[model samples]
Target: MDRVKLITIPKIEDTRGNLAVIEKESIPFEIKRVYYLYDVPTGAYRGAHAHKEQSEFLIALSGSFEVVLDDGIETRRIMLNKPNIGLFIPTMMWRELDNFSSGSVCLVLASDTFDESDYIREYDKFKLFKST
Candidate 1:
């Protein structure tokens, strides 16, 4: 609800396999850091936080997972199962990742390096911050 949307990463198909490509121009923000999630246990959760200034693009490199997005006033759930599609999350929106399938690989492209101060880990605090 907070302007979250999916991006289509151009892919080149062939008999051997398919290759999905993501360049600098594919995202709204310049990617400054990259990381991934893998081997997560079933029913385990990740990314229960919101950023104040940073944005992130998430891709399901393998298997599938669900992303829950909250904007203090509204919430939405999205499924990520395709390697050529991705989710873009803008600033100040609460996000949580769960419902991971076995062997799932989640790739994250970040707009900035890790910063402890930029994170809002509490839901109440995130709501208050959004209200202000």
Candidate 2:
């Protein structure tokens, strides 16, 4: 299975504020679509599915949240609370997002446009696909 890891977005520090860049070299894949989650209710979760062809880059743009990733055999949890850091989720990895703090904003950069056929939403189905 492919490994999930964190990538640091290059930051330019300034006395006024800071800037984080997500240009071509920022991530491995070209960003085809962009979206974000905001005002998520406490205890609510997001993204309980795996993709077949699309890769994703997730950033905690505002507050904090936890991401649980499973590669069929093993599971991992990561907390995102920084705007300049991001998590890269490759294809075939099942992920669940949770523990969103108030006002948390999650920015996602996708490698491809939305396609229902590319999603593997069931955990059982995900396991079966990984076993093959």
Clashing pairs in 2: none
Task: For candidate 1, give the lDDT of residue 124.
Answer: 94
Q: Show model 2 residue runs off by greater than 4 Å.
A: none
lDDT of 1 at 108: 98
lDDT per residue for candidate 2 within 1-132, as digits (tens), equals 456879999999999999998899989899999999998998899999999999999999999999999998888999999999999999999999999998999999999999999999999999999889
**Model 1 whole-model lDDT (C-alpha atoms):** 0.96
> Which lDDT tens digits does candidate 1 get at residues 40-86?
99989999999999999999999999999999988999999999999
Per-model TM against the reference: 0.98, 0.98
For this target, which candidate reaches the highest lDDT against the unseen true structure?
1
Question: How far is 85's C-alpha from truth in model 2 (Å)?
Answer: 0.4
lDDT of 2: 0.95
Instruction: Indicate the TM-score of model 1.
Output: 0.98
